[model samples]
Target: MVYDTVVIGLGPAGSTVLYHLAGRGFRVVGIDMARFPRYKSCGGCISVKVGELLDFDISHLIEHTVYGATFTYRCARMMDIISDEVVGYNIMRDRFDHHLLEQARKRGAEVVEGLRVVDVVEKKGYVEVECDEGRTFKGSFLVGADGASGITGRKVFGMDRRRSAVSVTAEVPYRSEDLGMEIDGRLFIDFGSVPYGYGWIFPKERYLSVGIAGDTLKVGGRIKDFFNTLVRGHTLLKGLRIGERVGWTVPTFYGEMPLPVKGRIALVGDTGHLVDPFLGEGIYYAIKTASMASSVIGDAIESGTPDLSTYGEMLKGEIYPEFTSAERLSDLVYNHPRLWYRMIEKEPEIMYRFYDVIRGKESFGVFYRWIWSKVRSKPWKVLRRWLESRFLPA
Candidate 1:
């Protein structure tokens, strides 16, 4: 059967595309290898900006409403850098993903699960997707949301697999009274704890999502050590036994890479490397990119064309510039994490202002420039700290 749009992967990106396209009266269908409520490896923190983009309410799934974060430097010298306003919302990825797919289904989108897409090819005017078990799907346009290690990114778009972040995460179940409201509405962020990345402890109703992430090639075989240190050294995580863990790669944005659109296909979310470079933020970008991809798809469908040439242009103007700026910030923050942490500790206001960036009130470029201006004003001190960071033991 032919569909107006075939969405590959039923996670946030794919389900969002299915929801938008089907709501527009298009015949849309989403396919995924896993069944509903399947586990996903993510920090599971959705920024406040996400609410503005979605038409429906996700409050029912929210386990916590984060007002700020509790920052630490190598699991020591903890400081609370909070905001009077909301920063993000935390939800388990399984429940969050299941809820989104159900919403898409409610919008008249069909879903097919437990079949992995092995290959995709453009034929005549429609794109053909060949799945395991001899199943097949045809659609006028295809949206690939299959994630970082999926065939859509590697086989189809030829995204560079070498340039991404690796992470190890575990959700340790705990009672609400165990945290004593210390982690309530606040994230636990530890800097200078990993190579080119950081550690995070996101609070949910039932568990504490603990994880450590770093550049895949940079961290290499040492990712396990970093994860172990984070889970053990964290004061809040003390006495909690970590059990099963999952590791995955996050495809961050790279400037010189090719656009994620080819012929009748467009890639979204992790498959497109739309994740933030500095903060590893993805959920907001996933849904936003889906909204953009769906709009462009609608336009192409209305014009009786399946080509997605304009989707690349749309990303260039809207999302690419912000990612470029975030990449620049990432260079400073990740490369010299110790110094960056010290700067934040000395001037907590710097982090308070960054919360604005997280809140979407300030652009990344603006915040980056502000940091540079502060550094330039006191070059000698900043230079001394930089040199010490280079020489000091991590």
Candidate 2:
């Protein structure tokens, strides 16, 4: 049977697209290579703003809610950034993704698991998805929600390739009663270990998720060593028993690459390169892009003509501008991190504003401009040098 929409990948983006499609009374089919409750390398931090996007409750998947963060630089100086309310929830991806897929299934979407999509072709106004299991499915439109390394957008639709960051994560099970700083509901971020990236410690229900990330090409052989040093350097996590170690590539949004919507095919989430450039976060962006894709595709299907040409326009109007601000801010913070550290040290309000952005109380676009405006009048010699260092090419 021909489906109204064919979704590739059953992660957050693909599954949400299927959910929305079925909710709109359309026939949708989702395909994925992995079964439900599969492992995905992620920090699994659920931002507070998630409630604004998804109407359902996910508290069952939450292990803990963190309201504060400790920022450590070179494992020496430290700063405590606190929020009035809960900042975000730490979760496990396997259960979280499985729940989302189950939601789609309950909404009348057919899920084809354990089947890899080998090829996708668009002909005669329909997209044909051929699976490695010697079968094919046809649909009105196809969405490539498969991840950064997935074959859909990169191979089938021919989207332009861009540089991606490499990250390594380990989940460690440790006794909560160990003598150390508070770990119940706090987030730890260390910036001294990796260049152009940071190390993070998020507390799950029964484990601590620790990881480090940096520019792939620049960090190359040093990533593993850096990750090892991050864990060893932290006194709280130094002696913990590691339960799992995994690595993955984050498709960071730099600028405009090839457009995601092409004729009868569209790409969502990592396949569309929607991950944030500054924070290396993709789950929220994945759901947002999936919502956009589903709305556009659902309308296209109902109109008896699937016009997906406006998908890029919607992204340009909504999501792409924020990415532009994030990229500039990333260049500033990553290139001259010591300068930023010093500035934040002097003015703690800067970090509060960042926390506000994470809480969805402020916009990154405005925050970046506010930072530039404050730095426009530089008095100190060190400040001038920092600006020159950032502006001048190395």
Candidate 3:
């Protein structure tokens, strides 16, 4: 069968692209290895900006709305940063992805579930995708939104190397009556507690999603130990009962690599490494990138260009700057743990301001200038903290 565009992996990115293209009267086909409502190992938090981009009320799909967050560092300094507005939503990936895919199908997209794309080949005019079930599909344009280990990136783009981090997450069905709320969500990022990684506790309706992430290459068998420490040792969620324990890999590091776009092939979302390194959040970015790719590809098709050369340039211009800034911030945080600790300890208000920037409530320029002034004002204190952090082993 021939399609105007063949999108592999019907996750947020793929499904979003399909929704936009199909709604615009394009012949789109979306394929996924698994069926709808599949489980994905993710933090499942979406910023308020995502709701604006989707142009729909996601409040129904959201498990809970988080007004603010509590950030805890290794120096025993914790800050409860409250926001005037609802900053984010905690969602389950299974339900969220399925809902988006269904919306695409409702708009006339041909969705093929349980079809694993085993091989892809670019021909003279179109790209061919072969599934494990011996079905061959053809499309003028191809989009790869599979994930970190995307087949489209490896086979089509030839950029096979990916830097990844391991994360172990467990969602427990436990209620905290003492909290006096249906949901109390907090993001705990402990540096020295877990090497090169951080722990998190996100609350849902009647469940709590707890997890930890780090460089798996450095810590071999200690992943389980780290998870235990977060649940057992942490004061916030010490007595939570375990329900379903899930673990997965997140690609945290990305360099200035070329995108997976050739004559007729384009990559979106994780396939193109569009995730934010500092926050490990990709849902909003993936949806936005997929929307951009759909518009560009649809235009290329209608104009008879038949090529996707400009896709890379568009992505680099629109999305790469945010990812670059996030990478730099991630490096600074991971490199100087004690500076992060002291900053939270001395002036906890900065953490709330930082969270505002993160949730897009405030401009990055304002946040950066404030932090820069602090560093310039106390250079000696910052240097002393860095030196102190160097001696402390992870």
Q: Which candidate leads in lDDT? A: 1
Which has the higher lDDT value, candidate number 1 or candidate number 2? Answer: 1
Q: Across residues 20-127, which tens digit of lDDT does each residue of candidate 2 receive?
A: 999999999999999889988888897888768787878889998988788877564777777677878888999999999999999999999999998998989799
State the C-alpha lDDT per candidate.
0.90, 0.84, 0.77
Off by over 4 Å in 3: 74-76, 160-162, 178-191, 216-221, 361-373, 388-394
lDDT of 3 by residue, 1-394 (tens): 6789999999999999899999889999999999989988887889878886785556787887777766666425556666666778889888899999988999999999998999889898899999986998999899999987668876677653436567789877765674533345454455545666677878777667788877657556587788877677666665557666676767553675767577888888887767777777889878988988898899988997886767778777766766776666666666565677667668768777777876777755566567768877989978887787778753
Error of 2 at 392 (Å): 22
Overall local distance difference test of candidate 3: 0.77
> What's the TM-score of every candidate structure?
0.97, 0.95, 0.91
Assess candidate 3 and give its TM-score to the true structure: 0.91
